[model samples]
Target: MPPVPTDATTSTLANSPAASLATSQGSRLAQRLQDLGPLLGLILLCIAGWVLNPDFATAANVLNVLTRTAFIGIIAVGMTFVIIAGGIDLSVGSMAALIAGAMILLMNAIGTAIESAYLVVTLGIVFALLLGALFGLAHGLLITKGRIEPFIVTLGTLGIFRAYLTYFANGGAITLDNAVSDVYSPVYYGSLLGLPIPIWVFLLTALIGGLVLNRTRYGRYVQAIGSNEQVARYAAVEVDRIKMLTYVVLGICVGIATVLYVPRLGSASPTTGLLWELEAIASVIVGGTALKGGEGRISGTVIGAILLSVISNILNLTSIISVYLNAAVQGIVIIIVAFLQRSRR
Candidate 1:
């Protein structure tokens, strides 16, 4: 009618609007399923727990597990950032112990001079945060500027940090000042409405972490670096700066965790955070983050953290499973998840 449509025009019309919409819908559906995988796995795990023990569904038990999960969950948030940026931190466990021991020592050293328990605690908090950030910065510099492998650098630092803790405590526990402990105990054991305070801390950490990774330009750089460092460098992204900052973020997360942890036990020993680095790394991987880097989801990480905690809780609740086998169980789960991911690829 309109001067006779050409063959190309007909073909364009055939593929326009409706076809495009259908394709877009299909893509979104695929993405939705991908995002739903971890959550679905978590639900299945919870169901299995209920089947294994009726008490697994109890509110008290559930809350207890969530509260305990907060510690590893917080650290894993930082681990997510580091891993997504194509790096790893093998020293978090030792770093946590170092921070805790150093903080307790600092507080006790000043406890006699400062009558204000609040002031002493505040100073301890500041010191812990600063130390964590500084240590992170140092690690970043060595990795970025000094051109060292993250694994090697963090491993060296891990031993150094744990040794410092041992020396600080003199092979014993560094207990917090009793007066300060009395004032700070509520921070960990206290409740906000019906939920534990630790849960609130975990929620806050996760929220900020998600925003940073999803909504910030820095996050884009992180993903870019991990995906292909050469491509990112060609695009004028500051690869070194972004990678270093990721470690800083990790350190701050560790600091926040130490703050919450100190209030619970009111002490720090060489073994305070022993073997925690593995748990944090495992949590990140279980959340569907690629071990090779370049992609991750924060919400999935929180779910993964919860899933691990639930398994540990279940194992504890069941006498049939030896408590010593907890680590073995975790290793098996990690292996299974890795195999599934490989198969999916």
Candidate 2:
């Protein structure tokens, strides 16, 4: 090459690193934007709803739509932790139904449909939580000590819990009769400064969940275990304890949600909480949390819940088709979300 002019060579040398740095920074920013696809999808869906139907964008409609998602969102929070820790919990849905049914029956036994019942409701909550913890314990022990797959263990509990709830209902609906109704109605329907009670419940869950997952040593152990159990064990982590603690935490979330959910529908049926575990998983995946573990995105999961509710809300508000097709729409959205996740990975 011919010798360059002094000023030309100086300018070239000064610009080269600047150009390379800009390219590197641009790539990083692009990756961040790409990682935000789910959030973008949620916003796009909301905007689409707004464009298609005026009412879908209203405050009343948004609040009404979101309150119902609180239950699933709460459960999904736990599912986020479980899946990130490299485990799964299928019995959450059935457990919700079972716990809700059991709680109603407990109140009913304490008094029929027409007596004062504060103590009963209090005890009912305590009992339901205990039952949830027990179920979690059973699942954790079986998987950790018995060496069975998490899938099979939770699946077995899923059927068992569903059957137990069905049997408790005796093939009929279990309603919160008048007496209990007065006592428990506010649990779900009550508002705090113009917001639904469950919304606050979910916010608290997110706050606590975030703290536990980010600030604690257990959180690091969990990520390590999920990323590689063998390596975690070799590093002297208490793999079993962390895993069991995670399941117990999941059970606690389910119990808390049940306490809120029962008063909303005011009854329990076999179909209560049907397919909710799938929804929870979908929300977790949509949040960009890794299914295989070692990574987590609680914020993404919350957004995922909002996105799903927004989709169904639009479908309902616009009266797009037969009510039966609602599942079809949700199913399709879930598949799309899943494919997006896999492709990103």
Candidate 3:
């Protein structure tokens, strides 16, 4: 047996180092493709849709899908902060729903019931931002001072906000009254210079986020903290403040998303923004932002959210059976994208 083993070992002398390297190089190429699986999947899907529908590539269709994506895209931008900080915010969907609901409620309660649609909606938007910030503040304090895990804290708030919204509408839809509806329609429907208002908002938000995350010292600290909070603190970083700021940023994003959201439906339901957190997370991960934190991809996240919206819009426009099944398809896409993202590392 030992003699036979010696011959087997001697076989290495028969192999060329060049061939061995070629094999290793082949393996690495395969790994790279695996890493790029999600991006490839997206490209493939786009090609397939283009082939399937002549209208799929039209400016109208593209614009429509992009407009819808802005809501989640904006929220995901804020989510980038929380995730990059090595925390999660499950309450985002509930938070958006709550804000949308409260905004509509406040518009109704506004003094003298202002007839100007934009003014009422403007008031709602401001109110939503402030309220969402309050919620974020609460979340930040609980997580920082109480020393609780962010997942647990956000999960608790997730349930609380969802339940409150349910209680808000008495388990039904909350339609904007006709008077308010007339005033609110233009906020979502109206456009500036032929572009949808939401589109402009998303572009601006992305630009601002890009500047903050990629061009500032605070961004460096965020990545450092996410990479290793212990090391960050030891380096004299303001860990608590950074963490709190992330939450607030996320809250403000949710508020912005809510402003666009309510005008679309002009009402609030417990279902408003349902599962949006999942979309936000998917957008961040798919966009190339790290799940465990440390790095972020703002542009990638923006495109990711658009891809999601496109998938949904195409499904709705096509002759797909059982509209309810659309969600299952979305879940599948998300799982596939997430799997690809994780596999890359």
Candidate 4:
């Protein structure tokens, strides 16, 4: 978190008639172009994939790409809020693993303890979401009330969560109970109205996120808080409260992603959600949200997530680069997009 200026500093800046404007001049055309950045990137990636390998554009491959996109895409939605509100969460990936592992362990115990209970799976899902929210709340409180930097706070929690997961899994995999596996598998692989469930979940999350960010007073507060903390304080915005809620929202999103994630693998491994924070951040940045905060486009974030999946999918289908090089490509792409975003500003 940046330093919150004092009243004197605020008054000094305000009274300076010669103070130069540092903010973007409101321009609808420029804002539209910025909003289109991720979509344009997605289009270019698709075109490249098609030109490189015709199979990349096939329906089956596209569906596969979307399936892969669902996990990170969902997480990125929450990340948009955190970043737009001027915060970061490094613990999300580890937090997801921790939440998923706990939920699985609970469900398995429930299955063994109560053979007749079919609601265990549902209970586990709720439990995971609740756990995620709690984790977020903890992070939020420590950062807001404690006045700790988000990067430092979330980084510490990231390691703590990862360590707990490792201990919970005994440094191995935590498999879902056989009895519950059959019952829970459909949540990940099953489809509704000819669409995979994860896709539907991502779409719903993005829709709600978009509405909250674009249409609500809370959303405006978020932007204000992120753009300029001092100004936000002067305007009577509850900076800490809004910032704390962003993390809570992020936690819920991670929990939802993990719920869908667990059924697909039928197990929780320590490796699950590794480095997901970096990917989610990349998606949000590519989506046109400034690293300095105060702006976001939910639709662009979704497109950015899909763009990442497409890039990976394309790399997997070709020999142009080794599989190990995929991460390198992603890093380079993120850097390039960041530069583009900076140039636009």
Give the winner by TM-score. 4
RMSD per prediction, one decimal?
8.0, 9.9, 10.9, 5.3
Each model's lDDT comes to 0.84, 0.80, 0.79, 0.82
Could you arrange the candidates by lDDT from highest to lowest? 1, 4, 2, 3
Candidate 3 TM-score over all chains jointly = 0.84
lDDT of 3 by residue, 1-345 (tens): 122222122223223232233245556676455446567667766776787686888888887887889889999999998898788898899999988888877887772467686677678789999988888888888888888999999999999988888897899977676777777777788899988999999999988987787666676667667767776787777999989888988999999988888889888998888899998998888877778886666777887787788777767667655787888987787777766655334
lDDT of 1 by residue, 250-328 (tens): 9999998998899999999988999889889988888878777776889978987897888778787777767788889
Worst 10 residues of 4 by lDDT: 15-24
Runs in model 1 lying further than 4 Å from the true structure: 1-31, 322-325, 337-344
- With candidate 1 superimposed using the best TM-score fit, by how many Å does residue 184's alpha carbon deviate from the native? 0.9
lDDT of 4 at 321: 87
Name model 4 segments beyond 4 Å from true. Answer: 1-27, 343-345
| Model 4 lDDT tens row, 162-224 | 899899999999999777988898888898887888889999999999988866767767776
Clash count, one per candidate: 0, 1, 1, 0
For model 2, how many clashes? 1
Against the hidden true structure, what lDDT does model 1 obtain?
0.84
Judging by lDDT, tell me the better candidate of 2 and 4.
4
